[model samples]
Target chain A: MSQFSDPDATGPMAQGVAIFGEFVENAQGVTATVAVIGKKNEPLYLRLFDEYQTKELYFQSLVFVSLDVIDECVERKAMQQDMYLGFLCPIDEYQIYGYMTNSMIKFVVVLADVHRLQDFELRDFFQKVHAAYVEYLLNPFAPLDGDKIKSARFDAAIERHVATILERPPPAPGPGAKA
Target chain B: MSASANARLGEQIWQKMPKINAEFFTLTYGAMVVQLMRDLEDVQLVNEKLEKMGHSIGCRLIDEFLAKSGINNCNEFAETADVIAKVAFKMFLGVSVEVASWNDEKTSCSLLVYDNPLTDFVELPPNINLYYSNVLCGVIRGALEMVQLRVECYFVRDTLRGDDVNEIRLELKEHIKDEMAEEYRRE
Candidate 1:
């Protein structure tokens, strides 16, 4: 049994659940997730990768954080199509690429510290996602329609592709530089 | 070059390049469309994502196509279409598409795909708005766009969607000059 799951564990409890890892900003300092909001305008499911997985609580909040940007986009009547929202600098450079299909399945990719990705590169990254999603759907063992993806193959793909864009720690606060 | 030499080129490229089982390719594409329907539950949306995904694949793979073929710059759009049908299709899918039915001035042409490798053993059910082989459209549009040829490529008919023959139409929109090429890169 995991200690996080134990009922006796005492730290801070939210709705009878104990919180082991606080929602962290840099849980996986660099992370990505595929978020799906259902027809009811409710958050249906999210497929998170890397340290984002560890800091599930924090990342969950970030989903809403990302959605706030979407609401802002709609309100501003901005050409939010194929737009990336930039936030959270000084601590880390974060860019969120949000693309919504005509059917309203929102595809969003969040990047940290790396800004060199070209439009085509980002497109290729999304293709990998499309490929992975297709792969999961074809499996007979997997459920046909569900909120969560249970395929290990898809998980590995998420980890593998997300690593390609992760930036190295900003030179480790080197000498004569702001620590 | 003689027809036999061109055939040899196709064969040589096929033998040299790495290949995967055709079923895997078919399933990957099939599943992509299936997931689109299963998730989004909208036909127009599925078509949009399918082509978008294919466009993404096309942009990346065109670079590989150019490097591996080591062919010279195309002198005309005629040769470009031929290379795509014969060389690119043969090298990747192990089959060549039939390029025919050119319009006046040869600015437009239709390529009839007799056997679409992406739809092998797959059938689309009735009452569903699905473009099963949409990735092909994206591949053509993307690959052509890279070479500064602004051509509109779409499937006039798809056998997977119960059309009599698989037909892809290509119409030249404009010749994008090198100076203004970057504008076309994103769109």
Candidate 2:
């Protein structure tokens, strides 16, 4: 059981957070947190992957705090068909990004400020996460009423894909990489 | 009618039907099932409620099916079964079913559903007795009843339960005949 108040911590994310913090010190572009929010702005799934495992509450609160910015983005660009909402606000040492599906489900990812990612890389990450989320929704047992996601398969999928994205070598040191 | 004829008819009807996104349909059904599970709490009750709901839909669907397909009536049980497996299932679900395992009396048979839209992305947890697609049995029963063919329908095998394929066993119980008042009867 996680010391934090995550609705369900039996997923693989909890395990990764618990045992994988040793390498987080040198972790660049590491995903600090991932969240899935329902249409009613309820947290459907949340995971904290920060190096400091004790900061789960802080990272969780950061995800909830971005909901307002995501809503504003949605309202401002209601006519746009793009699902990626791009960079939201940055707090303390983490940068938050947001994405919303056609059905109004929201995904938010927080990354440590060690490295800033390219816009296209962020879009790709969001698209992949969206696909996983759609697949998760297809599970007949998954709750649709904003309850927390508790499937180990879904957790594993997210963790696996995020690992692949993070494993990419840093971009070539061109003029564009100076940012 | 031959099996090929039914298949062709099914294909024609499927092509003409107004279609929604497959993902949307799948997610909606998934969401409904989850909601049912939460509300009912009991797995058996949720299964029953889904079947009941399907029964209502099936009752209304038969009329539209007849009107759209322009099919009059099947003369024999074999023909009806073929139509259901090849035509009805194809047109509505966009998947084909195989009719197999007929009893000697011709009163019972099984429908082999290989690719079920309802069971896509579904992984049942261990030790749970929930029938995820039980509603399909009710739909077939209610639809056949509307055509005056009383039948008993149920799941014999489910892919969700680790079966190779989803099999629905359908048994003919009764064939309702025309019984009208003297004044209403045709001369």
> In lDDT terms, which candidate is top?
2
Tell me which residue pairs clash in candidate 1. Answer: none
Off by over 4 Å in 1: A1-179, B1-5, B180-187
Top candidate, metric DockQ: 2
Q: Could you give candidate 1's per-residue lDDT for residues A1-179 as a string of tens digits?
A: 11222365342234122222233434345355555543333554556655334444433444556666666665574555643333322222446665444445554666544455676676766667656655655543344443455444555555565556444332232222211
- Quick one: best TM-score, which candidate? 2
Docking class for candidate 1: incorrect
The stretch of ten residues in a row with the least summed lDDT in candidate 2 chain B is B178-187
TM-score of structure candidate 1: 0.49
- Candidate 1 lDDT at B125 equals 54
Model 2: runs farther than 4 Å from truth? A1-119, A134-141, A144-146, A163-179, B18-41, B72-76, B118-128, B159-164, B174-187
Residue B29's C-alpha lDDT in candidate 1?
A: 66
Please provide, for model 2 over B83-172, each residue's C-alpha lDDT reduced to its tens digit, 9 standing for 90 to 100.
999999999999999999999999899999999988777767657888888888888888998998999888889987768899999999
lDDT of each: 0.63, 0.80
